[model samples]
Target: MAGTPTIFLHAELLPNIRQLTLHVSLPNSASEIDIRESTITLSESCRAVTVFTLHQDVELVETLKLPVKVTDASRRNLSFAGHRVDIGGTESKAQTAEYSFRLQVDPNDAGLTFTNKGFQEDDYVPWTASDMSTCAALHCKFCKQMIVDVASKPDTSSWQWKDLPSGNWAEMMDFWHCHKPDVHPDDKEGQKDIEAQNASVKGYGASNRVVATPRTGLVDVASFLVAESDCQNIKVLEQRPTSTSAKPASHDGKNARNIGCSGCSAIIGTEDSVAEGLRLYKNNIVVKHTGATEHVYETHSIDIITSSRFLDLIDHEGVRRFVIHAGQSNGILLWAFNPDLRYSSSSADHSIVSRRAMKVLYQNATDVERILEPENGVPTPLSLEELFLPENIYDELVLSLRRSNLLMPISARIFREWNVALLDRIEKRP
Candidate 1:
């Protein structure tokens, strides 16, 4: 028997174009391999692609299976047009070579009977206020200390969990909720005062300000905005600004400080200087809901939590490109290419289970101002939002991006100046 060949395969189906693209990496020289002698087979019965290489030392055959049947974006079954696949290009480096191939596909004939639909979306729900029980207790994930003890209250029903508006709520309000001020034309001072009042009210308005009130835990997309008095076993430490870093500022334009778990001394979140509350990060703490058979906690990595928030921001703000700054020197330029994609890799152990991912084009941006110029024939001015992230969260996100970059073949790693990678959005939590 021939030994298994060291090969890696990545396949992407483009239903819109009726094409399937494949990238195959093998530990051999391109000159030694005869592309004409190799053959590819697409079996609808098994929903897999089998590749045969006859030019190698020993005949090698490998099959890449799909979790779901091949289907178009609209769930219509797609059949292979022909078994012949065209090699687009090949790149050889050192002792390894990567081959790119494209195959044509067509929609199934209406007369033919087919009973395979593509796999549905994952069976996990994104975090929201409804997912949290009224009597939930928030505890530090590191130390397991109860930070917000709402379950201990006699009447938990009184406490409300109100979801805050999206990060770009102020911009949306300017377009949808704008109204002319009612002030006399003669008094300019009165008009100015009225305009200021309309732009920002005490706790709500057109400014990017979300206020937290008593007895209410304001929920953002990724964190909880709770009153400082409601938090226990936590300490606030002053964050001094450095030369390369700007002074830490909260959403409400006040000097911000670090909020840490007193028991473990882990930085959980930041203090809300304006609202006088603790913005507890969801990934840093665990929540115990009411009426559970066992102690169930939903925990996520910083990258996963950050990616979910990015999805929300895209849905609400409709902005795909963003400049995220951790400090004056550390920054990342993110252009979300595809928010949803289904992919499978031969390198993974569970290749049968296709994963959901977000395709992104990223670049390390030390000087954000320099990269803001137009590139790739962008007609209109670029619309980018500056995101000020905590240093720890920024580091995690960068690490996640780099780790995923290694999973791709060298040819697909970079797109011009941006590095191409996929961020897996696997959600198993109910």
Candidate 2:
């Protein structure tokens, strides 16, 4: 409805029949186009014309003919979403008059073949956890220890302060949620002071919906990772006490200690006596090279690592060079390569020479140049070829690219073209 309504036609060839389906998008007001009044005619023995009048004045007509003979024709008016028709090939009963269209086709006597162009080869398909596991291992960036086996227990969870309450009990719940000192008073005098302060507040003694309920597992909780029990492997690098008067309460109603990786001294998460478990922050931990290890904590669901996680996997050396290209739907295409190890070599290595040269091209090319430049100044774009890469590297790159929302829609052909362009540039530089 936003733009000119475009109709798409699909044709399939069977042994003795050629099936043609027409998908039409009509304006919201133009419902139920009388197919009986519409006209379909064959011209030049290969072209077909469909004409219908809507709103008594607006005439919708299409003219195209294929090499086929007319045997029978049928039309049906149905209500459906515009997107369903865009996807094509799906059959659904009419429910509403939001979207209306018609279909017309005839039997083939000229023996012309029919093919469906609705589906593309390069359409995006999501990667499974197993696909990702095959490319890289989940390990701690600092110690390089197997922190998580994503293939087995792919799920992660998190916890956060619950929403503040309202009414007389609002102040009390706020104090607890914020870990206020009065909520964890040390003496009867402090408790009495809090009670006396709220005494003037109406409905202070009345019970309301705001109440603390104990929950297990990560359902409806913040993102968290079940850390290994060996606290020795991880150190409490820094501690921010939420309670100024006293230590914060843990699961056991005792003091809590924020913890971190002992190896890298990076703030990883918190240790609460009340929770009696090491809760790792989802953002703090790194996932690197894969290895086989058993999970330290129980899991309910598998958390599929997504494109945003690619940043965490980058190492100290970082990427050799990177570029961003404007993509469809206002997205961005990110191209990055790992730092070249061949640069450290003394002699002139062909692989290293090619890699360095490719890096120069990437660093120097403008966004448009990167995507449109010809290989060796040839007319064809550099991406219109096959790319050669190590299996592991290719898989890793594909996974990251597919997961990233920044990239444009990836069809198999587009992915191959992009991959080839990048790899070919690198491999052919020397």
Best by TM-score: 1
Tens digit per residue, CA lDDT, model 1, 170-208: 566676445745556688798678657866664345444
| TM-scores of all candidate predictions against the true structure | 0.73, 0.22
lDDT per model vs. reference: 0.65, 0.32
Per-residue lDDT tens digits for candidate 2, residues 1-430, read 5453322222112222243333333333324555345444444443443434353444656443432333434323222323233212223223112222333335344332322111122111122222233323334444545443433433443212232221124556555546845444458688776666674463344343322222211211112324344234566544442322212324455444656555665545566443344654433444332353444321111111221122222221233233332121111233443211111111111121111101111222223343444458667543221121212222444444443212211111133324411221111111
Error of 1 at 156 (Å): 4.9
Q: What are the RMSD figures for all models against the true structure? A: 7.0, 23.5
Give the range where candidate 1 is weakest over 10 consecutive residues by summed lDDT: 110-119
Error of 1 at 392 (Å): 1.3
Model 1, backbone clash pairs (residues 3+ apart or across chains), number: 0
Model 1 clash pairs are none
After superposition, which runs of candidate 2 have C-alpha atoms over 4 Å from their true positions? 1-139, 146-229, 239-257, 282-406, 409-430
